[model samples]
Target: MSLSSSVEFPARFSYACFRLTPHSVYAINATILPQKCRLSTILTAPSFDELFPDALVNPSRPSDLHSDPFWAPTLSVDLSDASGIWIHLGKAPAAQCDKLLINVYKEYSNDSSRVSFLETLEVKCPETAVKWENQRAGKYLLTAYVPIRGCKFLCDSADKHCRQCLRTHLSLEIRENRASFIWLALHTMKDHSYEIFIISAVLVGLIMLVMCMGMVYALWKQRRDAKRVQEIQLTMYVKAMLIYADDCVEHRNCMRMLVECLRHCATCEPVFDMEKLLQPDSVIPSRWLIDQIATLPKFIIVISECGSRILDTTESRTHHLVQARPFADLFGPAMEMIIRDATHNLIASKRKYCIVRLPYSPEVPANLAVLNFPVFNLPDQFGQLTAFLHDFENIDQLNISQPLSQSRMTSFREAVRLQMTFFEQNPDWLDTRWRPIDEPAIPQIREQRLPVEISTDEDRIAAAKLYGIDPPRADSEDEETGVGPSNERQFMLHPPANEPDSDTDDDDLSTSEDEIDDEDEEGGEMHTVVFRPDNLF
Candidate 1:
């Protein structure tokens, strides 16, 4: 029987068969073969030399039908030694192909050559069936078959062999497919990473926004609190100014009080709005002097002994006294009318111009004037002054009306009486008593002597040194000696004293005196007179 013959074997039976060649051996099991055997002698088995002309056959090999053949079959295949095969499926086939049944084998030459059944799979050429002719020595084999009606193939007793299994059998065939799946997984991871980054950025922005809002709120609250404090301070400042104005008006010395108020107002560093108290058209006028005086309801005038002398002086007796008339002229007429009219009006109407006689001096006006109207010793004047400053403190309360329960007038009278008795007993007090205002205006008489003309150079030098001037040296003395410079000569000028003796030459004085006599001399009285003790007593 030839190796290519078909053999049939009975079911479940075991058999053994043998064949022999010049340099080969083959063993067969009859029971394992097909039941019918077809022995077609039309083709003869080729000699090992005929099958492979280049092969070197061993001559000492056995030649027996039962003995091992020169060619052997290896049942196992080593994929590690096998060359890989590749297959391509274009797009998708229009129709499925017939079932591909293949018998695979692994062959190994004694020379360590590797051959695989998978290599004969026709991976490059599709739609073809694969078959094996015979077994060879040093060869491994496997069988692969595609089952009809299934999406997979069967191989090596495995029921399912899909494209994934094809890769295990032939790694080269599915290289691109494996790489495609790897790239897809990487793309998915990239997308997930980007999403995570965006979410993190949004979260950070939200946190920053919350922080900024908190800061803004804090600043706004701080500003609101500061504004509230400023408003309270301003209100307090206004109230303080009002109180100071009232206090200033209550004191009878309105001008001095006004000056104090102005000083206090200037001391306030951050100036407050005192426009209401100082406005030109307001109840309190703008001028510092006018405001204090006009705001006081009433005031008293105190005249001292010195004031009386200034009013009583005559130009004829003491020429120096003539200088005082200008001062008297400034205030005299106004004082007389105010005192006379206001006193008369008050006495006739029985109105409260409560006059308490205090010692008076001529220089000081005995009457107080407001808008050219007099207010003379009015008891209600004290009451009015107190009412003006009821809201203020630190004022001269003595000048204002005392409470009815406390008699300020009686106390004042008793104190005056005591002082008068003391002055009567001690005459020295009268000498030191308040002098007339004219005393201040008296021209101090300096002793006069005829000035010696400094015609000599020595006199000029001495005069220069005495007056803190550069001395005329001997060199310049010759140019100007008799006529000295006007400034230097001033040190030598002195008015003549008693050269025209007035007591000895009365006629000489009368002629000059009548021409220059003061206006008061016509009436034989001074318009403003200082009442001496003789006139008063």
Candidate 2:
């Protein structure tokens, strides 16, 4: 479409200009009024309010003189920090920051006064290029740091805040892309924002201080409670017992030996045979076990790798001489005791029962596998068993505990002799007689005297007395060769390692007690009793 205009009026001089671009011909009209309008109406000025009503978002801080109406808040800042304050300007279409300007006003009543010259404080805008990554992540613009260090000029010392603050106004400007002059923009302004920030900062500071005090008090209380609980746990009169599968021969033997260790070496007095605790009329073995468990404060349950199989054994213990109730019948009560104890903390606030895994049986039984008082892994946390028992007695007393005395050693030997007698009772248990593999029935190898043979009657009596067993009588085997059943433990001593095997056919090459004694005196090597298989029949 073409138009012949007879009137000579400059389109730029009239506010009501009528025109449209090539794309706008069908979609838009650049002008707002009809073409047949009068010159008065065409030349009339347009109200900035009518053009952009929402442009004055904040009336107190209007756009700067050269700023576009739409580009109202071109400057942004975080004035909360008093020490280091910075003023930022939005990037131009060309992304140029060379013509940037910043000013700090001391006391400007309203924001419209920055246009003219005023008393400006000395400020520095350090030009630094920001990396593209930081610009994107931080939503950064053309950054010109107006380093308002200290901000001393903005101080109102009356109400102390952020080392005393005074509100100051700042403005920023950049070279305009389309317009001939540079664009001026005021910083984003809000009244009492600093006041709110100061108030919030004070409140936060108080809250943090109170929280720190509360944490300190809580820690102190926890430590005090723990100390009190420990004191309650340790006492002078601590009666503890040892428990294990009665069907497990290894467990029974370990417990029998452990009783002596506890009596002499350990801090607490160990109770092994609970049969004495049974009532005269009580027939149920479970009841006796339950009663013992209920009355006892501390218990050491011996669990070996094969303990699970022991629990599963329907028959009585294989090699043990003494038998009362089936192990299966007795273990149920013990399991019940474990379950009841683990469900809740004790009055002292810690688990009392300990699962003892000796070196012989390192693995824990499946029934006692997942205990709150867990079976500590071997070589690592295994000492918790002894630690628990130690808790039963006075810690100071345990620290000053002395080794077993001579009399106590005699008692220990007595206990060990009882175990040895029990070991010898099971005839099938000990394979002392060795026969040739080929010859089913050959002449038996006569038992040789011990390396330190029973030589004198007094030595025999002393040895018997040392083991807490009765000495043999004068008419018995005690006088013949001073070798008898009373001092049988010494017979378990291993012969010399280099001594020939007695399977040969030579009687002159026999070893007598005198020769053995001479050989023992000659060689300084110790004659250890081989300690007899730990009472394990």
In terms of lDDT, the best-performing candidate is 2
lDDT of all predictions = 0.33, 0.42
Could you give candidate 2's per-residue lDDT for residues 102-139 as a string of tens digits? Answer: 34332233554434433232222233221111000111
Candidate 1 Cα outliers beyond 4 Å, as residue runs:
1-300, 303-326, 329-332, 340-537
Candidate 2 residue spans exceeding 4 A from truth: 1-235, 247-251, 274-284, 310-329, 344-350, 374-386, 390-537
Q: TM-score of the candidate numbered 2? A: 0.30
Worst 10 residues of 1 by lDDT: 166-175
TM-scores, all candidates, are 0.18, 0.30
Error of 2 at 498 (Å): 71
